[model samples]
Target: MRYSVSEWTKSGSPWVWLNAGAVAICVIMVVGLLGLIAMRGLAHFWPADVMQATYTQGDQSRRIMGELVQQEMVPAEQLRGAGIQVPDGVEEMRRDLLKVGNRDFSSADFVWAMDQGISDKTLPEMIMVAERLEWGNFYGYLREVRESGETVARHDGHAKSPEYLAVWDEFQRRIDRVLEIRDQILTIEKHEIGSINYELERLRLEERSLELEQSTDAEAYAEIEARRAELNADYEVLQQDLIDLYTKINRDSFTAEIADGREVEIDIAKVVRAFLPNKMGTGEKMAHYGVKLWEFLSDEPREANTEGGIFPAIFGTVMMVILMSVLVTPFGVIAAVYLREYATQGFITRLIRIAVNNLAGVPSIVYGVFGLGFFVYFLGGSIDDLFFPEAKPAPTFGTGGLMWASITLALLTVPVVIVATEEGLARIPRSVREGSLALGATKFETLMKVVLPMASPAMMTGVILAIARAAGEVAPLMLVGVVKLAPSLPLDGNYPFLHLDQKFMHLGFHIYDVGFQSPNVEAARPLVYATAFLLVVVIALLNFSAIAIRNHLREKYKALEM
Candidate 1:
């Protein structure tokens, strides 16, 4: 209790406290960041109350309706600079960013309104927000429901009369039917017809290959023609089915009065969801939130990735990471084994180790460039020239793709694995190896049966590190394979099941694109946060899986280490 400063220092209590404090600060920062992300991103799914008001600017007045997005107080000088008139006495003004959709009619999907100029603000239960397949959301008052250009039901003004209720019911039923039709169309187009097209392409490639080889087999040519004919027949049938589905989906339409007081006819097929947020109770809002969140996760992105789901990006990110893991582990482990167990520990070996360490420090973008040049262009182009000459001019493997992206990331993160494995190998007691050697075991046998099993936990540690780095990497992937939108997933029900040559979407790249490159910045802001949080969750899941395996291996080998 009476220890001097020197004694306290010597006891290491100060250092321990400092270290613990640092760790605590780090944990707090991480949790805080994640909390912020979750709040901003996940809240986008919640149905906020929509507001209707009359907004006046100078001598002009107009009706405005939208969900209140954000509000901030700005200096009067800033408003004046932006050509907004403020009363002389006012030093500051509150500006509100409202997501007034109906993008087709309005020049902007979001608008900044001066709070002082807004009056008669009300949440009208009759107001409907239509989530659409195109042109963003449509916020308005439902006026009429029509079938095949004939009015089925109509409402007067913003009244929720019996006629309006009937119209609403009919609209909901039609939406459900259209959604079912849309699913069938998607299945036909993406799966059934898609498979047929793939087969047809393969047949064409086979014929080209035969021609390239100068094969004069008449039967082979006939067989290819026969397959093509069959595929064409199936395609025609699917095309007819799609046409019918489209006609059915497009048959119903509704008219809505937007904020500008113009009634526009919208096809039911374009409407993804229509909801009256003002009328919704807590339970209904929660259900709606769940549905919206699920759609964000499971639906394909629309409106330039500002709307819809990120499922494709999620799939691509996971697939590429998995591929990278598979490719990096063996190479890294082998290199570590050779360096630690077999190679002479000479000057050259020391240089190699230094080089490996340096490689880990190299800029990730540099790896991306190298990947683009060597992996995508040189190696892939060579393979294409040799094996796919028939598909020339299209580039095929010579272009950025899932395989090349994975390979590039593997190269980028392999140094981590090598270093980790070497450290693990160094920690293995020499006596353990000697004991195995003394017990009639060859060097290889001892390494395989004893040393490797003990070092596996470390190998997994390396893999977890690799996964964390590779999963979040966006730069290299952009150059190698990641795209703003991928037409089809790399993995599908095709013949090969996994198409490594296909380009793919990635969450990291998606966040960058949506956050920085989107035309609708306000609309895309929440999505960027949501996507970043999802990416964090995905990386956490992958790391947790690797950690579990590492823990199991560590537990299994605890006795050996002892």
Candidate 2:
């Protein structure tokens, strides 16, 4: 009988072939998508060069080259004097900047340094001559990467050339030495100023005391006047030293000159590490782990002289996530228990079911708006009027911040927990309950000891799902706790142990920042991808853990499946 249907279907249409084709196409699309992303995002870690027409206006194309660019004008000037023909026009017209694209040397037209020199244009000439001409990216750089130190793309064989690395080391060393020397000089100048001020103060006090004394002795007055004169002279010298120090510190600004269309302009900084090879992008190493997290946080304080630290954001996010979890778990578990165990499938139960299901579909932004109006304005405003009359906006618990974010997320996820727990309870056979009842156990006892335990695994799944949704979600939190930058983390040793009303930072928001709002989009690109991947991983880890727990519970109860 089954053979009849199977045979008919087999002859009617090639189902297997259709299915195979569908699967093949699906696989192809998936692979294509993954490959595309990989090519763009993971291909920036290696070295490549740029080749272009000698004219910038000719073609906006890139060519990969295998040379590094360092600005050492000394040798270039020397070579020019030797009648090296100075290769002026070629170096000047940087049509084809060098770069490594897709992480590796994607194409190979690069042999030696371009013969920009009229003659004797060897690699050494490029390195040593330090061309008076501009240093520009052919593709952009001769390093193994497109980024300074961070690895941009993977599988592209971009890395720092040994020569470039040496140059970087020397350059950095020189800068550090110069900075140290300058700092030492500044410190000495400051000490001199302090000493002078102190002496001046002493001399002024002596003069004041001398004037107050009705001393007929001319010697005492003469001594006081002489000391005052000496102090004045010292103050003049110190003031001059101070001005010089200020000028020196402020004047000698460092700049990295790169090639412009016609001439060279100072680029502010030369990233030799940009010439180094990296398979991943994480900013400069010293910047990352060099105890410079504060520097990174405060680097872009919104304005040029602005100051900010992501510590507050980091703290706020952690607090919001943890608080949201804590607030939602108990309420969700209780609701699920009542629905799964005590409630019957009557009109009331159905209504509750409908309501919970509807709640899950509600727009999170609506919740944020509601929270701001009702919780912040109505409730919190009332509280402020009552107790914190002096501090009108203080005690902002119900306001649009971490507290509201946690609450909104918790509300949004309650339905998920309810559904999961209900399913889990239903999976337990009625026989188990009947047996418990027959043994004289009450409904409450049966639910507590039997149904609830069995349903916990399902509840965990719901919790995990809720956590994933909450953690990665930027929309609701954006209206609630998300902020551009916070000076400190929410979990600081501030007065309040848990500042629910404080603005916080989340990883999702960070993705938005790097990808869209960051000043240097190309520079921050790898960070954005890495942050996104990390968030995905976090969600996956939570869900996988829940699944594992569910599996364990299933195994534990397998023998008792009535």
Identify the leading candidate in terms of TM-score: 1
How many angstroms is residue 379 displaced in model 1 relative to the true structure, after the best TM-score fit? 1.3
In Å, residue 92's CA in model 1 sits off its true spot by 1.8
lDDT of 1 by residue, 1-562 (tens): 5999999999999999999999999999999999999999999999999999999988999999999999999999998899998888999989899999988997998999889899999999899999998899899999888999999888876966777788888889989998999999999988998889899989988999999999999999999999899889989989999999888998999998999889999999999989899999999999999999999998899999999999999999999999999999999999999999999999999999999999999989999999999999999999999999988778889999999999999999999999999999999999999999999999999999999999999999999999999999998888998999999999888878999999999999999999999998999999999999999999999999999999999999999999
Model 1: residues with Cα > 4 Å off, grouped in runs: none
- How displaced is residue 482 in candidate 2, in Å? 0.6
**What is the C-alpha lDDT profile of model 2 across 1-562, one tens digit per residue?**
3467678686856787789999999999977865655554333332322222222112342232233322223345555565444455433321222222222212321222223421222222111111111232222322222233333222211234556555445544534544564556645544555455656655565555555555577887788778878877877876776676555434322223222222121211221123232322355433433333343333323321111223344445556666777888789888877876777869999999999999888887777777667767777678756654443334545456677778877877778887877788778888999999999999989888777777777777788878877777787777766777654445543345555666777767877876788654444564555445545655676678768977887778666664
Off by over 4 Å in 2: 1-39, 42-53, 56-170, 174-256, 260-319, 382-395, 495-497, 516-528
* Number of clashing pairs per prediction, in order: 0, 59
Worst ten in a row by lDDT for model 1:
156-165
**What is the alpha-carbon lDDT of model 2 when measured against the actual structure?**
0.54
